[model samples]
Target: MTMATYKQIESLMGTGPPAGAKQMQVMRWASKNPPKDPNASFSGKNVLITGSNTGIGLQAAIKFAALDAAKVILAVRSPAKGEEAKQKIIAATKRESAAVIVMQLDMSSFESVKTFAVQIQAQVDRLDVAVLNAGIAPPKYATEKTGWESALQVNVLSTALLAILLVPMLKDTAAKAGRPSQLTITGSFACQYVQPDELKLSPGEKLLEKMTSPEHFNVEKSYGQIKLLTQYVMKGLVDDYSYDVNGQVDVAIDVACPGYCSTDLGRDFPWYIALPTKLMHLYCARTAEEGSRSLVSGTLLGNAGHGKFWTNDVFTDPGIMVTSDEGKKLQRQAWKEISDICKQKMG
Candidate 1:
């Protein structure tokens, strides 16, 4: 593991869930107050959001459009649905049809992600904000065509790939706009719930390799673990590439947690799991629109939010795994593995 600076290590210490934090989060959810709509305007700015066809992504697209963004690109796996979502955003915002563009983006496939990136490069002049919100919570173990576990593939692998690919465009836009461009990746509080023992591995066994191995898959634990890996990727991006030649931030990269919103993310859950989750949603989950506020606010944080995790309208600790000694080692290992995969795939 690479040596992290003392400041970096200190930043993570004591930041995140204390003892019995998960229970406290659930209690807060029942009375969870929605974020006040940000007064910050995106007028004339172009924005893009993946998985915008449904859930918080769709709701977030509506918010961006209503805020007067020049263009709100809905990048989804299904164009037909993307178009439907476009209409919804337009109707909600009273924005013109031309204000929202639907683009195909299959997070399950690297080729598809690459194609989407190329399309963005070819068509858009400048992207002021991008929210990589496409992800899944599969109840059963499954692999995409890439042979990686579905959650790991979309939530961590392709997400890392897309973020890195979009950096140059974000940097270019920041230079022209005289403000840092925002690239917010959707993350979750679940990231903090994962325990070190849960991820115990054999000697020299790579964390990602073990997590993605079908023989070792654990549906109940996979989502949190994958989200944790996504946090690692976000940190790696900020540490390695977000700065300019003069050390000023070029792109403001950060993670946004939607706060366990009531969305279709659990639609595929087995009855056993789905029943409890639905009940929990009814009891405590935030509305999809309410959850989306974090994504919008996250993008507007500018340089102050770089490399930080934003949740519930404020920046907070990402959890112990992101700060502890053993966890930092895992963070380095996960970043090395994920970055290598992204580079190979991008090549």
Candidate 2:
């Protein structure tokens, strides 16, 4: 293994026992287990997966192509990398005409997001499943073009914006097709764990300092906070638009945690931290193909329970932090703040 990979795995193994025991158990179960339905497919489905150039996103795209999606839009930041990923999928599936298309989207930029949405609106009449899969983990400390904290911007704010912009299209598609359209957000177990009070950073505060100085300053907790906000926003969307007066669209919004898979998401950690993480990833981590199962289940297969959190086909409660009354209020406040930011930037 590369030194970076080795170090991540080593640190994870050395961190006493696993801090995420529940997550570990779910991973083990998924690793040894197979999907309940082996012959599932998504024939004639239209799927849009963001950040699909590598890691879990790439794997999910491949799966969608193999399952016979009518069109799989590989929404990615890097056009070159997206092309490479498309070729890999074509080679693996031997389906040259799988209708895989690449669209540019940098979730960190609201302008990019608006351009992407406009492109989709022009090209496609409706989107069956809009999978919000692209995300950046906690960067050392940075801000986006709009001066919002990077993690919150990329992980929470951008995701909510895209969903909002696409809802009308999704609803239109579902209305015409006579099926329930879906919005699946790939959340993390962290959402349930992070404290709600620290959802956003005050102006000029370093992102890393804000994250680590909080009483629960662990990496996972910070990450979880973002995920929690995503889920809460998702629930809010479902409540607001899942149905019309007569329940026309029935747009289902749900979240799922892809149990930590072996991906390059943690490549920047120190050697002590990165090595053990790599090992655990190798030994215990689910393949990206497997990781996409919950996502596909929630989005395409209609396996998601309405507004619930899922992993490996089972419905599990989100973090205690999110389920509490305080958590819900914080989620609302965060959403409004993000919406205001988007409005100002777009205007």
Candidate 3:
């Protein structure tokens, strides 16, 4: 690739569009020449992936099944869709019965989240990898039943609650098997590029109004803020709590970005923008298989000393934009606010 093209790809990687355009070009080139051994196996593991019915989540589920995971739980919103995704995986991997099981989960509802957690606790003795992969990137603003913004609740709050509820089962299973459990949250590069001021919704404001507000009008920024919040929560969970009374550490939590790939995530954007975005992704975005590399690395390939973030099978900085003093302060505040909201809702 020419220097200009390389710069474009890098800019796209950083800001999702023009700013990271060079990085994006490089990523496109890299995808064309992916590593020969992209199919790392995970035999004998029990894995759960939220939103496993479509897009990146579905791809991740298929990859895990191909790796021979003992059980690949498809935690999804629709049973029919979940079954369809499961069938697709089985056919693709040629796995036998019981390779993938569909479980009902609606991240938008706190009750639904708790119910899913309880069901999981009863049915599974251990969870080797929990991929918090389900998320929404709505073009128009929306709110859940609880009146919280849709993106925030689904992308950040629900994910954190699921981890909190499932942490014990993960800990118990890991302890018995004498292994370290792993939790991976799928974040986005938007986290670093978007401005923080656009994240909050005014009290009692309509979702659409909030979406159009001068301060919070940008869809890309809103999505990025939610992701930044996710990384904050993931990091805080592993670092804040002391060793358990029994002196056992909690499961390791790591965050990763898939960069940008061709997926239904941006389907709701205006047609003019969405069309070009889709075309660009088709030509440049990493294949679903390649997009999942950092996620898998953060989970199974991570080591004792591995830091919180991973990309392309290596520990790389999340960059000054995401790790700066101001950024860290915002992250800290976001965690506390989310925790408080969760306590009130989950109570």
lDDT of candidate 2 vs native? Answer: 0.72
TM-score: which candidate is best?
1
Instruction: Give the top-scoring candidate (lDDT).
Output: 1
Q: Which stretches of candidate 1 lie over 4 Å from their true place?
A: 1-30
Sort the predicted structures by lDDT, highest score first. Answer: 1, 2, 3
Q: How many residue pairs clash in each candidate?
A: 0, 20, 20
Candidate RMSDs in Å, in order, are 5.5, 9.1, 7.2
Q: How close is candidate 3 to the true structure, as a TM-score?
A: 0.84
TM-score of 2: 0.83
Candidate 1 lDDT at 190 equals 81
Q: Give the TM-score comparing model 1 with the true structure, all chains together.
A: 0.92
Give a tens-digit lDDT track for model 1, residues 32-122.
5665556567898999999999999999999999999999999999999998999888889899998999999999999999999999988
CA shift at 68, candidate 1, in angstroms? 0.2
Candidate 3 achieves a global lDDT of: 0.71
lDDT of 2 by residue, 1-347 (tens): 35653443233221122345665675665566633322346677788999899987898888888888788899999999999999998988877654888889999888999999999988766698888999877535556776666777787778878888888888888777777787888987666556545555566544334443435344545676667778767776776667856955467788866776778887777788788888887667877777776677666434235687766556667876567886676656655665666567657
TM-score of each: 0.92, 0.83, 0.84
Poorest 10 consecutive residues of model 3 by lDDT?
9-18
